[model samples]
Target chain A: MVENRPFLSFLTHLVLIVGVVIVVFPVYLAFVASTHGNGDFLSGLVPLLPGPNLIENYRLMLTEGISTAGAPPLWIMLGNSLVIAIIIAVGKIAISLLSAYAIVFFKFPFRLLAFWIIFITLMLPVEVRIIPTFKVVADLGLLNSYVGLTLPLIASATATFLFRQFFLTIPDELMEAARVDGAGPLKFFRDILLPLSRTNIAALFVILFIYGWVQYLWPLLVTTDSRYYTVVMGIKRLAATADGEPQWHLVMAAVMLAMLPPVLVVIFMQRLFVKGLVETEK
Target chain B: MATINLVDLKKNYGSVPAVKGINLSVKDGELIVLVGPSGCGKSTLLRMVAGLESVTSGRIEIAGRDVVKAEPAERDIAMVFQNYALYPHMTVRQNLEYGLKNRGTPREEIDRRVKEAADILEIGPMLDRKPRQLSGGQRQRVAMGRAIVREPAAFLFDEPLSNLDAKLRVQMRVEIRKLQRRLKTTSLYVTHDQLEAMTLADRLVVMNNGLVEQLGTPTEVYDRPATLFVAGFIGSPPMNLLSLESIAGAPGFEGLNLPDGTDVIGIRPDQLVLDQPTGQNLALAASVELLEPIGGESHLHVRLTGSNQAVILSVPGRPDIAEGAAVTLYARPADLHPFNRESGRRTDTAVANP
Candidate 1:
């Protein structure tokens, strides 16, 4: 039995080691292509290790790569993304928490209808509504701005659905207790309900941040001017070359940079996400 | 402290009526328990009063204020939940002080109320601990402390002890009764456990299928139940109700020979006796079907002579009879409850003396 146990673990370790390499190789390729010159990238000599050309590539990227179409600098785009993302994540989650709280904790007219309507939105993919959404954004004259990018994404259906499920599991007595404590709706949301749902918030934050960052088509349509291009949009155009050629290396570099925030957030946020799900079980 | 009043309270979920039209008045310093079986809408009614639920169509008043339209917060009431809903993130001290702080009460007064509640609940040592860190009983204490610190006009409890184990439920029952008495707060408690209702309530409201079957003091409801539903519902081992037509007073059976038209006879098992000296008295001969030894008492499942039907009798530790053995039993007519079988209403009768 002891021998079998040791053999089983050794086999498990071998499988995981191979699995991680397969998953990480594409990311490693992106990081490697970022440091190499355009020539080395064209020749397809994969940079397996760190290169000394980091500074030269970054300088070129800032001077010409990002400023090609009058778009903001790389750092400016990062800052804009940070602002947009913070607003989108916080706004969407606030709307989600409020709606879920009402549906789960309070009884009112047309509650079931509200629930069904919100749930039905999840049935139709956003891609299906892209044309209609684009027309609405154009009519609102929100083109080429941060508002255009973050507004529609701010009304979340998935987060609200998830949070409502979580809130239902919260005993009705807790809500009653909060009411008895003289906590109004806003006070209850701030003092009791929101504090209790820290884990769910953490989970939703990561989920929403990634969802907002990886957005391409909507941002592409909304921000018609290149000056307002999000990082993802910048990457899409970099590789969409004519004359039977594309900039694979620079495009990968921008993709790698755009991927950084969500990676960092997931690392920091996964702990609370797991903790929140665990707390719900209690 | 203030009284709670419900005028024509009605609650409907879609077309299914939960609490049909009912009126109730809870006086100040009174503890009224709503007792019923599952699906009886007691909890729904309580939530409506708390404003956690809409009235559907009704009026509620607390302290002579028209609170039907008032916010739960504006109503100035407190509630204890069955699951002991202590804020999981907050320490016992913060949980107890949260309301006072939100209400803009003086900081020093908040501390005083928190301290008093902590002392009363004996949770002073655990004030800094989060609710997740406390045991079930301790968490229950903190939930109560959170409400107690509020000092609201009235308190509402929703099956607060139902989550505890049997022994803990009994212990918490007494503890809650003592706590409510000390506070002298008008309280409305809901539970499906009739034992809890009987022991804890100053006045008990018995509900069944969204209707008030009877509302009276525990003794009044127990002794003179207004309906067969009450007689069948409000006791430990519920009262035995056998129709008078189901039996004939044959050879050994000399049971109560009431008028031929009597439909149902209700008798609590303990009121029945064995070895009757007067054959003419209320007595019957029955074959013992099953004998259950329940520690200090034995429950006999007996089949009366000349009848194929059964009746359960709760007697002392042991009765001198084997399971299949036939024996004569005696009971007083004062212990008998005659009910109009079709309507399930009580027939006029005399009460039994202990």
Candidate 2:
């Protein structure tokens, strides 16, 4: 941005354009393929432009779905994905806010030990303990339910640590003043701490929502019923055909549908999300 | 209104004592300023009185009721912190009303008190603004208004004006003094600025190193400092402490009576005059090092001719004196404060407190 020479400016724009094409071209191809008829993809090269059957291809995926792939219609999977994502985001924020509050404010015995236990969980994400987590969910009879879909991934150490670090930067005098104002710990958390953490909650909600949205392995393992199959698992089911080549048009349509919510969420909360991540002056 | 009595109060952080054993009595409607340098435990003492800090061992009585075990809210005292700890998320009106709402005050009463505080502080215009939107002085007013709306038994101010600019600090200092007088509430204020301590305090509790060095009215502490610490800590340019051995041969020491074991003699800067005064006086021959003219008065930094010990003379106006010029400075014997090396307390009287 500082250099304004003609050659440097031209080089800068050239590099940026190339990078944008590298990243966006695949998504562009998915959109292009989603617009085409099923057999048109077998013509060897993906169409560079929109085709004649864009609405028809999307409608078929939404209503009739690919029965050959054994996945449910797109609408039901999207609904399930939305529900799980929303629940995980809300549940993680609530639990993490309280846990971080306790860890930072209270002086109970083994306080650091408790915090470290939560922090150490960062090293062992769902992927590392997928088998045991699935076994526990199965033993609890929570399979094929929304609880099974969201609960294992709900205890987020990263969000808890983030909230804890943010909470620590708040001046202690605010708490002292609140206590002098006759606010108990719970009242202080609700009245003072909660409102102050609004942006952070929004930021973490976007992240945790996307995290829940893209989950594949755990949801795939827990839910045997199609009712509980999230869009992520449904998309994988749609792509891995048992008998022949997968329908590239239907799969790309499902891919575009699955990518919509998170993209919209990021777009809507983008300002607050970035502010919560970088702005620490408050 | 209430009287605060601290009976042998102490606070120990691990093994290090922040506020060692101390006793202080703040009468109803008396504004007692605890003045000391940093790490002197003045703020710790104020916090202890506010019940924000747990008492290591002692009794704190407010209005004749024991409150060492009580919560800060239960103690019925409000504190204005140094940072003006206004709730950032709350509007000024909301910040003023928060305490009353928490205490479940009647809605009309809260409104009435907040309005009164706003009127008094002249912050009515800023009622809807957040702390970040207001200027530093406005925020300070809000901080005071927050305490005033509480209608508490006592107010504790922890260096509330230290965060302001110099001009604003002087303005707020005067305003705080006027406000305290009008409210007539028992208050404990802590600050490291000696000038602020001298100006605002009805009674000054000069402290040093976790202990009260002297406790009296501002003029009383200034005129007769109980210890060398009070002597040095309370003044602007600070009292000059000349070793008795170094000034033994000086002209002024001939008529000065002996106080046995009085090795250090403290003299006020203003007391050292260039012209000889009547009555018994100690004349020290010295050469000027620097002349600092601070508008109405000038501080002449001089070094003793023989021993080369530095002494400051506060003259009334800009004197036509050049640096390195030999001048004989005279100080009356009565103005001298005698202190022993070992005790660090005044040797002129058995009891340092008058």
Candidate 3:
């Protein structure tokens, strides 16, 4: 990158093009597969180009679904995924922002102890605490519900720690000025702190939203009802149909649909996400 | 406008005392500047007065109302911080309007006050711009505008001009002085810059090590510093304190009579002259070590030939004196400030001036 050598430039672009193809080829194949009819794979090879059954396959999957797979329609699953992802993202951000605010600003007995406890939870991801968490949710009769899908995943130590670090960078003089300006603690948090954290929240929301969207293991464990099935779990069901060969076209269509929301979120919030992660506005 | 009274104000961080018990009164509409080096507790004292820092043991009365237990907002005071601390996300108008809005000032009143402050600080054009969009001086004005819109009983400035460049600092200092005078607001300004303290203060409080070294009009403090600390801290190049042992047995030592226990004598740099003396004066033969010609005046660093003591002479314009040249420096008796080494008090006064 530093030199103007012609051979180096060609080598650099060659390396980049190869890397791009390696990453993008699978997604391209999935799109090509989704556009084909059920009979197209009779030759035991995936067709690499567009097919005539694109709309019909997507419509069938979104509406009636693959009935032989015994899974709910793709539309219902997509809606459920959207709701859970949104709730989880928003809930994580809200809780993280408040917890970070309290940890950074207030001084009370065992303040650092509380922060350390939250920090320690970073080691205990959902998988590590799954059994106990499941037990609690079952006892509360939250199975097959949206709350069950989102609540256990909502308390994010990483996001809280990120926000805490960000808040610490904010000048103490600002708080003093706000206090002198007659703003109470809550008012200051809302007016000054929240606005200042816009980019960070955007960045975290994109991450957390995708985290919620692709959730497979926990949602599979929590939800028995087809009413609560997510697009991710639904995709798995479509591919692993109990009887006969799986419909590759319909499965590929579902996979494409499942990847859409997270991809769109990243695209839309990319600028803010990069800014939040890389820069400190204050 | 209101008067501010600090009754034995004290602050302690655990066992370490930041502000020792001290009492002072700020009269209505007076601009009292607290000047000190870093960690002298001037900022702490001001914060305590603003109710930003808790008082260890003392009373604070703003407008004759005790406010030691009051929240910073309830104290009804506004402070301009050293970094300006303007809200980066908010427009300049919102920054100015925040305090008034929080106090529940009606929309019309807030607008009017914001408008007036913008006019006074000449920041009207910047009202819609965020703090980051403005230059340092413009942000500083917005900060002042914030305080002005508060309509608080008093203003506390914590080294507000320290972030500005030297030229802008002088300009802002003048504007702050002018604004304080025009508004007739009781103000407390804190800075370590002695020149700033001298120019802006209605009365100056020179602090050292959590206690007041001297409190007087700038001229009074400049003319006669109460203690050794004030004598050194309040001057540009600082007053030179020559020990008696250094100047004893010199040419002029035999004729002059200093007070008892006068172990040290303080003399302003400008008081030491090159011209031949006409009055009772101490004349020391010296050789120039260095000559610093700083524009209209020059500092002549000289060492006395008798005892090899270094003394600075402030001379008008630049003379033809070269380094290592022999010169005779003179100080009259009246200009000699006698001090006791152990007590650190002026020997000329019977009792300490408080």
> How far in Å is the alpha carbon of B272 misplaced in model 2?
0.4
**Model 1 global lDDT (CA atoms, 0 to 1):** 0.82
Chain A of model 2 scored by TM-score:
0.97
Residue pairs of candidate 3 with colliding backbone atoms: none
Model 2 spans with C-alpha error above 4 angstroms: A1-3, B350-354
What's each prediction's TM-score?
0.85, 0.97, 0.98
Q: Judge candidate 3 at residue B2 and give its lDDT.
A: 98
Pairs that clash in candidate 1: none
Q: Each candidate: what lDDT?
A: 0.82, 0.92, 0.91
In terms of lDDT, the poorest run of 10 residues in model 2 chain B is B345-354
**For model 2, how does the per-residue alpha-carbon lDDT over B1-354 read when each residue is reduced to its tens digit?**
999999999999999999988999999999999999999999999999888888999999999999998999999999999998899989999999999999999999999999999999999999999899999999999999999999999999999998999999999999999999999999999999999999999999988889989999999899999898999888979999988887999875777986888999999999989999988888889999999999999999999988889999899999999888999999888889999878998887734444
True contacts kept of 3: 0.91
TM-score of model number 2: 0.97
What is candidate 1's CA lDDT for residue A86?
Answer: 82
Best-first order by lDDT: 2, 3, 1
Residue B118 miss distance in model 3 (angstroms): 1.4
Interface CA root-mean-square deviation for model 2:
1.2
lDDT of 3 at A241: 79
